[model samples]
Target chain A: MSKLISCYRGAVDAWECDQMGHMNVQFYMAKGSEAFAHLQNALGLDPARIRKEKRGLRFKSLRTQYKSEVHAGSALHGIAGIRKLDGDVIHGFIQLFETAFDRLSAVYEFTALYTNLQTDEALPLPGDLRDRALALADDHPDIYQPAPFVGTVMPARPLKHMFESSRSSVDVWECDIFNHIEHRHIVGYFSDAATHIMGSVGLTRHTVRSRNLGSAALDYYSEFHAPIKMSTPVLLKSGLMGAKGKIFRFGHHLFDLDSGEIAISTTVLGCYFDMTARKSVPLPEEYANFPAEKVLAKQL
Target chain B: MSGYVESYRGQVLASECDLLGHMNIQFYISRLSQAIWNMCYFVGMAPEEIKGSKRALATVHQDSNYLSELMAGDIIHMETAVLKASTKTITFRHRLINSATGDPALTNISTVAYMDLTARKAIPLTEAMKIKVNELMVDAEDEA
Candidate 1:
């Protein structure tokens, strides 16, 4: 009951930080995930063995709480412990800490299911696997409810921009190893479309230096009420959620157009960048010259 | 090794391809990683051996490009060549190959650095390790 894995340490790189000089939220989870994978290998339960043994675990949901910002150049460490194991479900607690100063920066708790790798459905853990996991859970017993932003489906809001053309499908090549579309791909879709829209407004990347500030995403969240098979057409719906001064929040939903179901919902917290001073800049006055209603009516 | 150790393999599964099947993207990386790890062990950098020396190769930057589709039952071979070596970094270029017909599957480049986990930063590679790696590099090149 006293098995405690040593902490996994990873240094924050310059590329991992955003323009805001803070570690990007997506990267924070990425670091934890890296540690988790290594931990599995250390447990003698690497993926190949799992595949060959016909047993695997899939992440069902995660609740992450951002306690403090981790700036670039910080040495980040993660301490993971099994919190609870119920039948086929294992809940884990991971704390991201600044190792140099010993300060807690972020906490992530995840719900995962033991399943047949070939079937992707919740299944009972193999007797030996369950025994090992139970031993770990018993040693560390601090269990808490997952955070709000983890697994909950995002609200489906209507689009604010009025655009006539819609993109029906995304190229298959853009999908990353996760089978789920990569996070950057989602941003790429809108960023590319934004450039075109900005063209109508007579703006270019060189003309206006804008930057993404912060973003929140639910990796496993699907808007579709039903299963979405891969390679199926995923229709995207984009809209402006709100804007205040220079700060704007945008919402996006990717759905199965044929099934009329949602596949992914994303909320972006971003701002216009001055690019010169490298500071947050307000939305340029040039935007006022464009037809706000036309640009903000339908999903862009 | 001063020169890279050349090894080759193909991709039989990819992340998005799992959408139609049961495998996930994580597994794809995991399998490729195993192949690489096994090769490294064959070259004398097994985890236990590295742990005995209180040193390990830590991954710093890894970027993967998926070029072609890999379906189940496809045979993929990976060829790895050391690109450069320094006190801290070991750069390798890996090519994924299709063994059935012999074609490229994917290309990935990874930069790993020698790390002292206790201190947690880049450190110099041991001279003995360097000599052994170079020996393996010579053997691999000679075989090629």
Candidate 2:
């Protein structure tokens, strides 16, 4: 196996933390994106060459897992290695570590397609570039582990039982220059639905304060299927997937109301907590009897 | 399956976009957080009730997929529904759509647990509140 190479080194910024008091998920993506660019450079696919050739890489899919929390002032670095190459596509892996304690903080796996910018068509890597990429290809088991739901193929079957949880129109503030919705907002949409669902079950701030309890997410996985444009009417559908002990899982589907196509799929894992004790706890009687199987039966 | 209820509406601002010129992922989550509050209020668990009861929902995990892109100046709306409600936690799904194209820009799924701010422990929904919550469940027979 080829050796891993350093791709990015930086410090966590104070501004990156969210209300939950840890680094927000978007910053993790930003860091991984930068590392991917550096890895491309290491493979000799520099910006100048790509610009001259009118060729570039487009992200086809991404999977990330937050293993540990990083606080502001935490020095961080990323190491990357090529995993596989097939024709015009490249699969890569990156590992992020906090330098202070030298602990793994997160992992990212991504697939990118080489494309002719002018024609927007997939193209194979040049012979020389392919050789260079292969020279650096490695799958270090100690440094990387497969994240759940990364390889799960979305079923093509149509949704049977779905609830329209939230409906919203795109706003100018939510779009990037490419006129596409930003990644952070996609997560925002999911969060909105989660809040509504929790409220529907009396798990609101009012109830929490009265009960001395709280909630927190343990992990997440998402898959992108299509692209959406500005000012499009969107629909989101959701259902229960399953549960194990204190952990519960849920699924969501995003649709473009205009095209009537499924655009995105997402899953989340979460846990209950005791605020005073600051530890995970069991479900209360009121919430313990949810018909998980009934809900799962309705999932697309 | 619950029917969708209109939860929140807003316009995207230019400031929310990243260097790629698309909306930043964090903003999407922030807006959804706002919508959750709106839905809570609509369901009779307004801020006043929260303040009086000292209970709140805290997200434990959230997953999102960006299917389409939305640019600045796009008017966005969000709809939310309950996916599951268990003893300690509940899951929700949200959809964001662009008004001009009438297409879904993104979809999100999130799970949260009820919390007691003072004790910081997981709690159960009251029997009375559970009955009210059942009202939010979608009628499985209804088609989208």
B59-131: candidate 2 lDDT, tens digit per residue: 8888888877765445566777766678867666778866445688877877777777678887886665465
Clashes of each: 24, 100
Instruction: Note the Cα lDDT for every prediction shown.
Output: 0.53, 0.65
Please give each candidate's TM-score: 0.47, 0.58
Which digits, one per residue and each the tens of the lDDT, describe model 1 over residues A41-151? 434455446546655555655555655566544555666777778667777766777654577877766666765545545677767767777777743544333335422
Residue lDDT tens for model 2, A1-300: 347866655555558775555677767765665566567666776544654776656566766767777765455667888887867678788888875467889887777777665665667788877897778776666676775563233343445544677898776656644455666677668766876655544467677657766555656666666665578788887655655578666667788889888888776776667766757777545455665444554443
Worst 10 residues of 2 chain A by lDDT: A150-159
Residue-level lDDT for B22 in candidate 2? 71
RMSD of 1: 11.7
Q: Write the per-residue lDDT of candidate 1 for residues B104-139, one digit (tens) a residue.
A: 666676777777757777777667657655553433
* Full-model lDDT, candidate 1: 0.53
